[model samples]
Target: MNFRELHQDGCFLLPNAWDVGSARVLEAAGFPALATTSAGIAFSLGRADHDYGGGRVDRDTMIQRIGEIVAGVGVPVSADLEDGYADVAATISMAVEAGVAGGNIEDFTGDRARPLYDLSEATDRMVAAKEAAGGSPFFLVGRTDVLLVGGTLDEAVRRANAYLAAGADCAFVPGAADAATIGTLVRELDGPLNVVMGLTGGDLSLDDLRKLGVRRVTVGGSIARALYRHLVDAARELAEHGTFTYADDQIPQSDLNALFDPKTH
Candidate 1:
């Protein structure tokens, strides 16, 4: 099914992948669709996430990596293009050219003094992205970082609704995790709502979110963080104790070879 159809009725889990290998693994696990995680990609590249100024993972590298992930998986992939790297429409056009079925454009400015763009400007950006998409079957997700950056729920709702009106297939509010907040957002949002799970304080399960009427659930960078934590622990064990106990339950090399083989996998 297409990305937009996944959000039509029931809720679906959109796991984030940082590279071709990760994307293939997630696709093998049977998810109908996948998404790119900016944080995960940055950390894998030895940088920081959400580099709105192109200081960390520059726009070109990010686009190239996104293309790689899309090429690696058969399932539909969504690009998490953070703030469109300051050129919203152009970045989205690049993402479309990269073959992403859909992508997110957030309202975060990356400046502490003014963390989010003004509602008017943000709506304009959404319109530009929609127009850039043209007749392509691209799903445009409008994301608001207001609540994630300490803004009020009312303001978040306002910005999200405005973006939806301007031309967004879905509204993504990342910070609302609790049952009460999520329920309120579901009730208040005029369109499909996407909530990111697995962050700190996000204990709700898929069933919990589905019961709350959420249309989409994503686990932004949590999977990547967990994997890195395991790597760090294994390194410490090998360095401090001179042991290799972390190799337990590792995926067999032959199995991975088969999984990656073009003719068989």
Candidate 2:
């Protein structure tokens, strides 16, 4: 199915990949689509995720990385454009130019003192994004960090509905992991619902979320963080214990090569 159709009915898992290699590996694993995680990309570039303190990777760099992933994969790829890189119009245009089929524009302002955009300003940004997409077949996901920034569920629903009315194809509430909140949003919102998985108190199963009427499920940066955790553990073991046991569960070279081989793919 096309990327847009993925949000029409049943829920599907949209895993975030940090680079072309990871994107290719995920596509080989049979996921229908992929997303570029801002955190993952930042970590790969030797920086912290959402580098609010400054020194974040620039927008052009992100667009280039996203384009590489699109070129490397056969399935649709969406991007996690952190605050639309601070310019809604340019970010949307660059994403489309980079061959992205979908992308999210969040309301987080990257300011610790004032974390989120006001509801009206946020809705206007979404409108600008939708207009920038023009006649292209782009799925513009309107995301609100309200809950993530400690706002109430009611406010989240309010902002989500506003964004949808402004022309968002989907509304993403990152911190609404519990079944009740997810269900409420699904019932109240007019468009497809996108939820991030593995939140502290909101770890519902895929079947559970689907039953709750969720349309899209993404892991955000959890997969990248988990993989990095394993990497750290393995490195610590080898460095501190002088053991090679970390290689025990590694994928064989042949299998990895087969996945990357163009003809095989």
Q: Give the TM-score of candidate 2.
A: 0.96
Candidate 2 minimal-lDDT segment of 10 residues: 197-206
Query: Scored by CA lDDT, what does every candidate get?
Result: 0.91, 0.91
Tens digits of per-residue lDDT, candidate 1, 83-176, equal 8877888998999999999999999977777898888999999999999999999999999999988999999899999999999999999889
lDDT of 2 at 60: 93
For candidate 2, give the lDDT: 0.91
- Runs in model 2 deviating more than 4 A are none
True-vs-predicted CA distance for residue 208, candidate 2, Å: 0.7
- Residues 85-120 of candidate 2 have per-residue lDDT tens digits of 778999999999999999999999888799998989
- Candidate 2 at residue 20, lDDT? 89
| Residue 222, candidate 2: alpha-carbon lDDT | 83
- TM-score on alpha carbons, each prediction: 0.96, 0.96
